[model samples]
Target: MNYTPWDLVLDAGFLSALLIVGILLRARFKMVQAMMLPASIIAGGLGLALGPHALNVIPFSDQFGSYAGIINGVVFASLPFAGSFSFRGKLHGARKMWAYSVSTYVLQWGLGLLFAIIILGQFFDLPDGFGLLLAAGFVGGFGTAAAVGSSMEAAGWADASTLGFTSATIGVLVGVVGGLALARWGVKKGHAKLATSLAEIPQDMRTGLVPVVSKREPIGHGTTSEGTVDPLTLHIGIVAVVTAAGYGVGLGIEALWGVKVPLFATAFLTGMAMRLLLDLTPARKYVDGTTVKSISGTATDLLVAVGIASIVPSIVMSYALPLALLLAFGVVYCVLIFRFLTPRIFKDGWLERGLFTWGWATGAVATGLALLKVVDPKSKSGTIEEFGIAYVGFSPVEILMAIVAPFAIIAGLSGQFIVATIVLGIGLIFVALMGGGRADAGNRANSFSNVAP
Candidate 1:
């Protein structure tokens, strides 16, 4: 195909049209909706149709090669600005917060890895070193998958990169699936359950957690009107700082530890670290609601759009059945497991946290956000705060996982990948143990209060 700059421009237009079609279908068609159709998977399918791996309609060229990259940078760069969603005072509930974070992180990551090993590993012909990279990509999302994938390629394990990319591509699919399913769950069960507890929330807690919807507009009124200091500006600026700072910090950590990590992970960690510092100081005000919502929402939309457009269809087709099965089973298993075990093993906020973590582990920050929105639109404070912190924390984990995956493969530990998964599970359980007491206390208090009496 003879191509020119105009062709590249056309590609973008094609993708945009496809996205609109996809979104519309999501809105109108139940079978193709976000939860049922699997947004990423559908997007990916469209990409396959448009991308060179299939019809070659969106063939890669110098002009379009970096198109996806530009979109990614735009999406990611907006993160820090969105960092302000979570409420400040909520973190003060020290023991409970700690318990929730530790337990959720452990279980989410652990279960993800275990599932990868037991299910995905059995079907996909993953090379040894790349197994972890593949796992991280599918389990940890794109940043981790790419970070480790690139490392594998650099270390002369190019085959691992192939697997990693393939896995990451599928992981995004899983993310959409998991996120949408969770949203359905939240709307059906989680929402009502949470609302009951929220109705009786302490006045003080409600004060901290209630979304201070601008009184300037009536309920359901869209976007704050013009001339009001655009909260998006603050969020965009903060996100820039967070991304740069994160890269810098991750570089420093790599230099000190003599280990490479995922830049996204580093950026995420850096943002979280700054969040902690700001929370400690009087600077918490720097992160406000508008900034958080704008940054997070915009970045997520961009990421999802770019991600769907970028997955070369040929790659997806190469591993079609396995990837399909991985997503289908993973989504089914995760929802069921969390549904049953969450109530039994953990209580209240921990269940929500676990659900959110699972979404992040399977997908990315956007998935988490969508799920949280369904879980508690009113308590923007708790949901946003948790998301902001989790987004940052997830960064380093991705980088480290990505870079180390290839080595694991070369060492022939592919068969024993379950060991690493087991360790992750144990860690989650350990955190749950620490937080279980506080969660029980909170649950009791919530239950006895009859929801706001």
Candidate 2:
């Protein structure tokens, strides 16, 4: 059957309804409240249950995966406009944070590939590109996995996309559940600055709803004229245009080099260029950061829900044992990074930084923010603000890892492993230089002083 635009609208409407149902269920259930699970995850579970693989209730359109990919592009394209990217004045902390982010990326890739080459390669008939799934799932989350996995599928890795999505799904669950466990552990060990009892959290927060008093104010100062475009519409239009431009740029690159680049990476760069252009123009005044953030948030929620719902059960089941091993190793690796490396590097708010890293490394930036809120509700730890600044320097490395690394693996799997190991070695040396020796003592003292409540 040829699906029309109305089919898209209908599918979106159904998902929106599922999202509402998930929210209501969360609000009414104690188990979900304790888990602090996002409505998106619940909605995704509902979708998976109702989808074709599980039941015959909901129509699983062939275009569902494409919807996720397109929305992922929008999410990345909206990012640069969502906040200011600053690189001035705070040099030391920013450099340390950047190093930390890159080190994690390199380590995850290196370790993942080593496991695949030495262990999985010996017993399993898997492709060389299988190692990339670790960083793709953990560091890049579902969006990058879906985007890059699609590219890999085109490059002749038949099950790459399904494996990527499966890894992402597991990463999200680990990020939420394991992160909460780590948060409580931090409190027990006196690492958290402000620990709250379960009963102390607001009902709305526990239930995943905005309290009446805490609801965000409208974006624009006043309503638009009857004939004029609404501020929200205007912001969305800008994102749409930028997203299309990014798609075009990706196509151009593919045409020129005969190698496909992930659209989200290009979209992010295009967003940055657009932001810079806006900063240079007077039109920047009309753009609201909040509105851009809202757009990105919506795109992310939809991407997560659809990405999870679209997972092929047979593919996941086929690679179950290897996938389980990869995820198990990832959990241990993330925990060690937080427990040992984070405190040695961050001079202040080590717990907050560790929690944030665990969140993003396991899931997405939104997960990091969620974990940050759980531990530091008032944003007093300064983790989010500092990480935002550091991301300016870190994002290019992320793009390279997400976009370039997969293609390199496709070109020569052994060569990619060698390169990944060299990068990981360099990352380890950088971490030692920054965190070891005299700096470790000063860092520990600063961390204690900052978190001593």
Best by TM-score: 2
Q: How many residue pairs clash in each candidate?
A: 16, 0
For candidate 1, lDDT tens digit of each residue in 1-453? 577878767766766666666655565664453353334445555765667656777654534433433333334444443444453543334433343344443344345445556667776774444225434554556544444555555456544434455566666666656665655555456433454332332322222122455533221212333486454555566677777776677578788997665455556566667776777886566556454655555444544444545555565567667656655555664565466645544454544555565666566655555455445555432544434444444443444444444555555564454567457655655554554343232333333221110
Where does model 1 exceed 4 Å of error? 1-8, 28-31, 34-44, 57-125, 133-138, 156-300, 317-341, 348-358, 368-421, 434-453
lDDT of 2: 0.77
| Model 2 per-residue lDDT at 323 | 80
Model 1: lDDT equals 0.51
Give the whole-model CA lDDT for all candidates, comma-separated. Answer: 0.51, 0.77
The lDDT leader among the candidates is 2
Cα-based lDDT at residue 297, candidate 1? 53
